[model samples]
Structure formats: C-alpha cells, structure tokens
Target: MQGFALYPFDPPGDIAALRADLRGWLTVNQPQDDVVARANCWASFDAGFSRALGAAGYVGMTLPARYGGGDRHLLERYVVIEELLAAGAPVGAHWIADRQTGPLILRYGSEAQRERYLPGIAKGELYACIGLSEPGAGSDLAAVRTTARETAEGWRINGQKIWTTGAHFSHIMLALVRTEEESERNAGLSQVLIDLDTPGITIRPIIDMAGHHDFNEVFFDDVLVPHGALVGERGQGWKQVTAELGLERSGPERYLSSHALLAALIDAAGPDPDPAVASLIGELTAEMWTLRQLSMSTAAKLAAGEDPMVEASVVKELGNAFEQDMPRRVQAIVDCAWEGSDDLARLLRALLIASPSFSLRGGTREIIRGIIARGLGLR
Candidate 1:
C-alpha cells in the first residue's frame, strides 16, 4: 500500500514444506485432462479445478477471511501461483481477478460492491477481465477513447476494446474509460465494472498469434451501467489502473509460462547435457531465475501495498525476453516428433510456436521499457 512491498520478498524457510504440501495436493487434484485438452493450455478454464482450489482455500490465498478468503500471507499466495504456473495448471479463467481485480475491488469498491462481489470471487464462482487495451491503443492506455457519460439512471458506455483477455467467459470487466475532459490524455480516465452480458455489449474471440482463442475483441455500444459500477472516484482511474498493472506484471507467471517446455527439454536430454545445449539452457534458466526473483521481490512490494510498478515493468520486460527464448532454443536443439501434448517433443513444438506472443500479450516490451524509464524519472 505504501511502496513496492518487495523489500522482504524472500519466502519463509518453510517454503520447502509448503512446496511439498502443494505437490501432494496437486498430485491428488490435478485434473486428469486429455493431452489434447492440455495443449489448449488456458483455454479450458477448468471450472472443476477452480472450484477445487476454492474449496482448498487456495484461490483467495491472500485476501481477508471476511471476504471468504484464506487470509494467508502474500508470499504464500505467490508460492501457490508459482507452483500452478510451473505445473501448467489451467488458470486463465480467474487469473486476472485472483491476481488483482478482487484486491482492487476490496481496496476501492464500496461496501455493497464488496458484499456482492467478494464472496463469489473468493469462491471462484465469479471471474473478472480487464478492459484497458483498444483497437489502436493496446499499450498506450492513456490513448483510450472509450467514453462513459452520466445519465439520469446511470452511465452509458460506448467504445471498443481489443485484446480483452477472458471477456468471453468472464462475469465482469474492470473497464478503464474516459470520465471527464483532460488536457493530458491519461488524466480523465476512470475504472468501472461492466457486466459482460449486458445489452449492447458484444465479445468476439480473437485468435492470437499462437492460433489460440483466449482473448477477445469486446465492443461496448451504448452499454448502460449503474453509477455504482465505477470502481473508484471518477477522476482517479489512472492511479487505479497503474496499481492493477503493477499486480499484473509482477508475478512468477510472467517468466514461467514456458517452464513446462523447459522441463520437457531437460527430461529429453538423455544421459548428459550436450555442451552447447547446456550453455543455452544455462543461459535461459539463469535469466529466468533472475527474472523470477525480481518478480517475486516486486510482488513482495505489492503485498505490502506499494506501487512497485517500476520494479514490475523491469521484471516483465526481462522475463518476457527470457520467456521468448523457450521456443527458439527448443526448436534449434530438440529433434521433436511431436508438437504440444503428453509427448515431450510435441509440447516443445507448441511452446516454440507460442513463443512470439510471449512479449506482446501481457504488455508489450516497449511499453514496459517506457514505464521503467518513466519510473526512473527519465523522459
């Protein structure tokens, strides 16, 4: 809440025990999904697994019990998420909300908002999506032109949002909209809660570079929402959006999406690591570890309620770069007979093909660099 809470980011010595516990739990609970289903990665949504996590009190690991959460430490939550990514869990369904939307609502939403949203969110029954990027303004959030005007009844929203992850299946969207006039583009933005199924709202899937349909092009055509939908004060959206982005960027998931592929590569290496292969793996793994530590440290800052946006941007950029290498190095070395499945070769191939989107989807590397520079007070 004050600054990047990452200062005391290191996990407790009991992390090994936590890891063991998580492993045992997952061993009993990991969905027995078909390899083809698994290849779709986050596409499955895995409502069953999600409900299991909620039942285990693992979904809302860091939120207050008052909201039906587990009330665990922030770092403990980090451990769960990190393990999920490493194990290649299907987490895309509640990813954004679990990571930040729920917290964002708790921090900024009114009492009624909390009462209505928190329990469902905590139970993994409700899902959240973000509505920030637009057709021409993906990374340049300040360039948003979506307008919400107050009406006698509520607000009427009209604009189109692109690259909207989870919009198709999400219950709600934390939409960043223009609420007032601003000489500076970023100044008048505001975050609002928009119901996905509301009239005048349409969501069509957008197949990303990897030929996956996890994202969407969402259009708001005179969509009406109550004034209560606004998340915070009308003029404070920029700050809220930045806070959300910080939470989004600084997580183990950023660098570890392709970790399963990396493990597959290692397992395929029969007896000994080839000298060149070892160097490449070493380079990637070393960088991945560094990025992960940086990310976890940033998460530490966030857990303490700090902006840590600058730190997050640094980690995202670096981790994204490292993540991009999974496909390249795997392709160059491994003679795989498969693409992405139970077969190690197939898994490596899919990861390689999906590598290009690694840097683009979450936040473009360029946007991250600019944020880092701005964080350093550089123009």
Candidate 2:
C-alpha cells in the first residue's frame, strides 16, 4: 500500500466571511420545502432557484470571468458547494453543469463551444447530463459501446445511454462514444457534445423507488451533430472522462446526502438527550468531520492541478459508507415509525430509501475499492 499525505485545505480570502455571506443569502432565498426533500438535497431540482443562485454569482464560481463566471479560486467554489449541500439547497437543476461539465468544457472544448455553452451554463439556466453509462456499462465506462460515425453530413450517432440523471431536462449531453471503427475498451473513444433537442433523439424517465424521475434512458438513432461537437482530442476520451470522474467522486456531496437526517435527529434529540442518543450524535459528527477533511484535502490537490485519483477514491469509498450507514444506524436506535409524519421520522424514512443509490451513483463500491487497491500497487 502507498502512503498518502493530506494536502493543506487553506483557501485564500476570508472563508469565514464567505460562509457567513452565503448563509445570509440562503436564509433569504432558500425555500422551506418538505423536510424529506432535504435528504439527498442535490436531487431536489428547482430551476427557478438555480437561476436565482446564478444571478447571485454563486453558480459558476471557478470559471474565468470572460465567460460570465466568478473567476474565483477553486477552494472558494468548494466552500460554496459545501455550504449549499449543508443547507440542503435545491441545486439539482444545474448541479452537473456547474460541478463538472462546465469545467470539462473549459478544459477540452473548442473556442466556439465555450462561447456557445459557457455563458448559459454560468447563468444556471442551461443543464447537462453525462452519457457514459449504458444498459450493461454502469460504472464500467470502459465497456461503453456507443458509436459515432463521421460522415460528410456530420457525425451520425446511434446508441442508448441508461441511468442518465437529468437527461430528460438537460439542455445538452457530454457523451463518450466509439469514434474509431473496431475500437474496443477505452481506445478510439471521443467525447461529443450533443444537444438534447436534436432530431431522432429520445428521452424516457426511469423512476426510482423513491418515486423520483431523476434517472432516464436516452436514445439516439441516426442523430447527427456538427463536426465541432467533438470535444478535446479524438481517441482521448478515456483520459478526459477519467479526469471528469475525479471531479465527480471527490466532492462534499458524497457524504452529505443524508445530512438532513442527521440534523433532524439532532433536533429530535434536543440539547439534553438520552446518553445513547448523545453518544450516537457525537459519533456521527466525528465521522462527518473526518470525511470533510479528506474531501477538502482531495479538492485542494485538484485545485493545485494535480490528479488525486487515489485520494478521491478513498474519499468516495469512505463517504459512501458513512452516508449509507448513517440512516440505518439512526433507525436502529431511534423510536420512530416506519412511515412517521414527524420531521425526524420523515427524514429517516426518506434517507433509508435513498441510501441504496448513494454507492451506485459516483461509482459502485467494488469499483471504488478496486481503484484504491490499484493506487496502493495491489491490483
């Protein structure tokens, strides 16, 4: 196993003031939705709230100012993301665009593509979905079989993408496709920007156990896009997508999915609680603090332009365990009905239902553990 050091998470500027300001802003702007909505809050979509956040200069914090971004430091953006997730803000509508797609485009997209997409993305009105998973692919992105054949007219795409979150509502999709004929595994693949409204494209929702239509199935049949839709270098999609996954796996969202349940538990326990409940709260808090430190260190490494793939996998793996275990632990000790109506009971039920998908979203447990093992020279 390789030894790892925690990078310093010191961000320039008054982080205290920044957090205070954002808290104040959220106080005035955040909607008082159902308590259940606060659990897995990132999946709570609200387009109007997203636009409001963008208008407040919180949407595209790290992108260059020329593209209507805040041009702030990456850690500063990280602080904002932390605050938003902690507050259970309904940021689902523009989450992908702000988190990874916008940055990915800035890094590998064409000038025209940047000019066309970045502005809208910064505004938070435009949305994007990742087109990496297929029926059997899931987290095994290397197994992607989607194809995009270049023709005189344009690039004709014909394949299906499954479990694409927000595809039904997104404006665009950044897809990995087999660009070179006879390509196998990750070779000869390229990223392409596809407008969701393009002809011959179809999107159908797949409701989860929670009855949310966040995931979808996207289909492309002879769908043609311009030659410029290809992002970065051809035959380098594997590298680009790997970098994008680093961004996806290391954020605070990995652990904060069931935070509302924790908050509700604390509230239900009150300031003076039974010894066992107090002990449980202390343990959960300690675990959360540790995860935050790991995630912050990983984010700092990324901000310094280094790939912390191993550290990120570590965060994702541990964070997923923390989140999935939290609700079950709470249910085990708490005296709450299975379908209770109180805030604590409601949040507990909601998180228990949502917990199963936490490990599956960024990457499955087996995949994340495999990445960590490889990083340790064991694979």
Candidate 3:
C-alpha cells in the first residue's frame, strides 16, 4: 500500500472549553449503568439519554441550525463524540441518525425528505438503520438482491435485509435496492429512505453472542414508499454508500468502544501493578493513541470533503485488531477470574464476547484489506 499522510485535526474555536462543557454535562446526565455496559457503550441504547443529549445541543452538532442542529463545526462534533464515547454515554438510540443518516439525508435527500426526517433526527427522537446487507451479500454490498420496482403510485420493495443494526427500534432505513430490472452487480442500484413502520415490513431481532438484540433481520414484501423517498441520483447508490461507510469506519468509536475495559483494567491494576500488567497497559495505550491519531486524520480528511476510504479501512482494520486483542491479552496476563463480578473481570468478559463482531460489522477484515490494496493499485 502507498504511504498515507495524516491530515491535521485542527477544529476552530475553543476546543478545550467545548470538552469541559460537555464533560460537565455528562457528569450530571450520564447513566450509571453496569461497568460491562460501559465497555461497548456506543451500543448501549437509552432513548431518554439520547433525547436529553439532543436537548443539550450535542446530538446534531454539525448540521445547519434550520434543521434543529447546532450548526457546529465537524471537528466540534468530533470532539463531542470523543467525549461521549469516553464517558460511555448511551448514544446507540440516535447514533446512526446523528452520525451518518442525518448528514446523508442533508446531502442527498430532497428538501421535503430533509424537512420530514432531519428535525426528528436532530432532536434524537428519530432513529435510522442501514439497509445494505442481505442474506448472502453480508459485507459484499455489490451483491445485494433486494429489489425496488418503480410503480405508478410509488416504489414497491421486496427483499430481506440481514444483520441490520437497530432496525427493531429505528424509525427509518436508508436501503439499497435494485431499481432497474435487468441490472447487475452495483449497476442500477438505488438508495431509498424507507419508514420502518410502513406496511409489509417486519423486523425480527438477531440476538448476539452477548445476548444483545443489536442486530436484526428486516423483511419487506411489496412495501411501497413515495417516489420522494429516493436519495440522490438513481443508480448512484454504490457511491453514496461508499461515502457513508467512510463516516461509519473512521470515527473515534473504532478505538474508544473498548475504552471502558482499559479504564477498568487500570483501576483494577492500581498504581503499583504487577510488571506484566503495567507492560500490557502501556502497550494497549500506545495502540489506542496511534489509532486516535489515524482516526482523527481520517475525520479531518472527511471534514475537508475528501474521501478517505483507504484511510478509513486502515483505521477500522487496525482498530478491530487492537480491540479484539485487548480482552484476550488481559485474560492471558491478568489474574482475574472469568466469572468474577468485579469491574475488571466483568468488563473483560463482556468485551471478549463483543469483540468478535467488531471486525464483522463495518466490513470484514478481508474486505477492508482488499479496499486498501485496491487503493494502492494492487488489485
């Protein structure tokens, strides 16, 4: 792969004050959930907390004020996200809407669509799920088989989307479907914004190994949505979805999702930890710092309106390795019992169960590496 340059993450205005203000808000508003829940905290759903955070002007920080947003800088939003992740705030309820859907709609959806969705999204009262993966497609988005035929009245959608995160609770879904009858691969595919409550749509939960209902299988049979539900140009879904993946992959969430475990490990180790524990802590800290720099650079490139697909893949790949390795490494060296109820042991157990899905979610490791390889002109 070619060398990647780091884009400086310099957000304008008083960043320190922003962090301080957010930290203060979190101190009062953040939930006192189980330490295990804090480990992969982004997936911890709390609707009330989401609404409160939105009311505090932290949910839709980057969108325009007319859309119920703060009209804040992208990097400003980045700082808020970092703080929220670090504090282990329950952001899952509005996470997809605030992070990607809101922006995607602002960029591609019609004015009417924007007016209908953006305000509720910014208020953290509306949620969205991605409708990309199908039964056999998985991360191979080009292989999607969901068909949406254009009808006189509207578009009729018929297909099943598997592994749809938050679909059970989300208000809407930005779905990729075959719009043209004879289209192949990525061709003739289009994005449609579907309301989850529409008729002929069924969302069944897919509980994870950790016993969490974060994933779901959504079925659509003759589901019809208005023509205006289409996002951006028809047959441009691949490009739009690629851009959305960049946002999904390059965030602080890539590394900070497992931060609670690190914090718990440190607390359990105490100041005078065993040499092995201290060494492991140092190693994990270094990896996290490196990931933060890479993720921040990718975010900066994105803020400047540049596509950082390869950079994002690199971040996701490395971040997944770091996260998946953390629990294993801790288990190997730490003397904590697997079934123990202590904070460190509980976090360790939770993360170990959760880490397996880290690489699989954004994109599989092989797929991500292939993207990076293609970026390097090696494909």
Best-performing candidate as measured by lDDT? 2
TM-score of each: 0.92, 0.99, 0.99
Check candidate 2 and list the clashing pairs. Answer: none
**Model 2, residue 43: displacement in angstroms?**
0.7
| Candidate 3 local lDDT, 1-379, one digit each (tens) | 5577889999999999999999999889988877777888889889999999999999888989898989999999999999999988889999999999999999998999889999998898999999999998986779999999999989999999999999988999999999999889989999999999999999999998888899999999999999988999999999999888899998999999999989988988899999999999999999999999999999999999988889999999999999999999999999888899899998888899999999999899999999988988995
Minimal lDDT window, size 10, model 3: 33-42
Tens-digit per-residue lDDT, 1-379, candidate 1: 1343337667655888888888889889988664334442544587778878788777877778998988888899899888877877777787777888998998899888888888888887789898999987877778999999989999999999988888888999999999885536888889999878889998999887667778899999999999899998888999898777778787887787777767766777755988877877787878887787788778787767766778888888887777776667777876666533446666666666776777886688888888888877788
Relative to the true structure, candidate 3 reaches a TM of: 0.99
Q: Which stretches of candidate 3 lie over 4 Å from their true place?
A: none
As a whole number from 0 to 100, the lDDT of residue 338 in candidate 1 is 57
- lDDT tens per residue, model 2, 61-124: 8989999999999999999999999999999999999999999999999999999999899998
Model 3 RMSD vs true structure: 0.9
Estimate candidate 3's alpha-carbon lDDT, on a 0 to 1 scale. 0.92
CA displacement after TM-score superposition, residue 355 of candidate 1 (Å): 1.8
Off by over 4 Å in 1: 1-6, 10-14, 34-44, 181-184, 337-342
